[model samples]
Target: MNALTGVLRYLGNYAISSVWRLGYGARLFLLTLLYSGESFKRFQLVLKELYSIGVLSLVIIMVSGLFVGFVLGLQGYNTLEKYGSEQALGILVALSLVRELGPVVTALLFAGRAGTAITAEIGLMKATEQLSAMEMMAVEPVARVVAPRFWAGVISMPLLAALFSTMGVFGGYIVGVVLIGVDEGSFWSQMQSSVDFHEDILNGVIKSFVFAVAVTAIALLEGYDSKPTAEGVSRATTRTVVTSSLMVLFLDFILTSLMFTS
Candidate 1:
């Protein structure tokens, strides 16, 4: 009886805490949006954050994209060859990358790389009382710090996703056409014919943009709400990555279903 009571109590507390955090996160997101005008007013801050969040993430994205494409090419060719439809390998690679893998994988990578960085940086600022100091100096940390990073992430994510898809296509070409001896003309022609701009490319871009908003918002909220201590900062950073990754995947499913449910 005592164990059952304890279990119920724990579950209740967990549910309440989750609700509180969600409400707090929603409030923070609204506040960030409200104060985002400062970010645009001081465009250089957004540019600086773009370099930090976007430019720094390029190496991992490109390398991972290339490898993903290579794997898709090799595996796709093998599978299609069995069915005597290997020429369709190009469309397979292109569709897979453009329609799903590119945005999803890039978002996952961004969450690990840039999302954790945003959380740690802001968490440390909170821990060190820097945000408090800003408040004392009549500066809104949300406007000055959080908003710029938010817009930067919003702008960077789609561009990075596009670059990743482009690199993946190039890698696929190298693997399929050069190494695997698939006809270059057929590969290009099939990819061009089968990949619809509105359906495949545009939808991928939309997914990346939605993922950007979720990831950036979650990272900033985790950092801002973390307890003001070293341990708290560390935990917040971990939560940022885990939560952002999960949110991206969840949103991806919803978006994919809505976009492709024809």
Candidate 2:
């Protein structure tokens, strides 16, 4: 009963606090735009995060994205061939990569890598009383710990999204041209012509930014609330990854619906 009550209370606190923080973040964003200096630190942090989140993770995303695209092309071609629309393989690959698979797969990949790292790192810090030490030193934890990660996510997600889209297309090209015997030039041409780049790319990029924020926020919150014990830190780390990943998936659904509706 105590554990159940604690769980319910945590959920309640999370809901209220999340709503409040979202509003606070929005206000700060607007206020920062009003003052050039307020945004500069975030900008620098963003660049660092881009290196960490986008450049550092490049190889994994490329390898996974390449295979995903290849499989998409192969599977799509097989499916469309039965319906006598084998030529539409280009369109199918482009659509899937842009609309759905790109963000979800990329976010999942990111969560497993950086997401867990952020959680474990923060949890360890908290468990070791380092955060308390910072407090004693008059350092603001939010500015020191949270803002950089949040801004980093916002900055890096779009770059990663672009990576996913471009690499996925390349993967599709390989399968379409080499294995499936389609002309390389024609496959590229068809892909270019079939999709609305502005719609697909912009929507995905925006979604990536949002996913970045979601993942970072959840990770930070888990870290902040982690217990002082090793078990507590471990549990917080696990919960951070699981919760962040699930939230990313859910947010993707809402984002896709909103993007496609208009």
Candidate 3:
């Protein structure tokens, strides 16, 4: 009886805490958006953050995209050849990357790379009372610090996803056409014929955009809410990665179901 009561109490506390955090995060997101005008007023602030988060993440995104495409090409060829449908491998790789893997993988990588960096940087600033200093000086930290980063992530995500998809298609072509001897004409033609611009490509762009919002928001929230200490900053950075990854996967499923299911 005591154990059961204790378990119920723990569950209630957890539920309440989750709800409170969710509410707090929603409020923070709204405030960031409300204060976002300052980010554009000083466009250089956003441009700086764009370089830090987006440009810095390019190498990893491209390399991972290429390797993912290579694997898809190889595995897709092997599977298709068994059924005498080898030429269809191009469509397979292209569709998979454009529809599913591209945005999801890119967002996951962005979370681990740029997302953690944002969280840690903000967390450290908080630890050093920079945010407090800004508040004292009559500056809105959300406008100057948070809003620029938010806009940067939102703008960078879809572009990065597009670049990732492009590199993936190129990698797939190299593996499928050059190495595997799939007919280059048939590969390109089939891929072009089968992929619909609005259905596949646009949906992928939308997914990446959604992921960008979720990831950046979560990272910012974690940092802003972090305890002002060294260990707290570290923990907030770790949470940024884990939370963003889970959000991407969850949102992917929801978006896929809505977009693909009849």
- Report lDDT (CA) for all predictions: 0.93, 0.77, 0.95
In candidate 1, stretches whose alpha carbon ends up further than 4 angstroms from where it belongs are none
lDDT of 1 by residue, 1-262 (tens): 9999999999999999999999999998998999998789999999999999999999999999999999999999999999988888889999999989999999999999999999999999998999999999999999998999999999999999998898888888889999999989899899999999999999999999999999999999999999999999999999998999999989999999999989
Q: Model 3, 108-192: lDDT tens per residue? A: 9999999999999999999999999999999999998999999999999999999999999999999999998999999999999
Total clashes in model 3, counting residue pairs 3 or more apart in sequence or in different chains: 0
User: What's the residue-level lDDT of 257 in candidate 1?
Assistant: 95
TM-score for each prediction?
0.98, 0.82, 0.98
Instruction: For residue 92, give model 2's deviation from the true position in Å.
Output: 0.8
lDDT (Cα) of model 2: 0.77
Tell how far residue 169 is off in model 2, in angstroms. 0.9
In model 3, how large is the Cα lDDT of residue 185?
Answer: 92
User: Where's the lowest-lDDT run of ten residues in candidate 2?
Assistant: 30-39
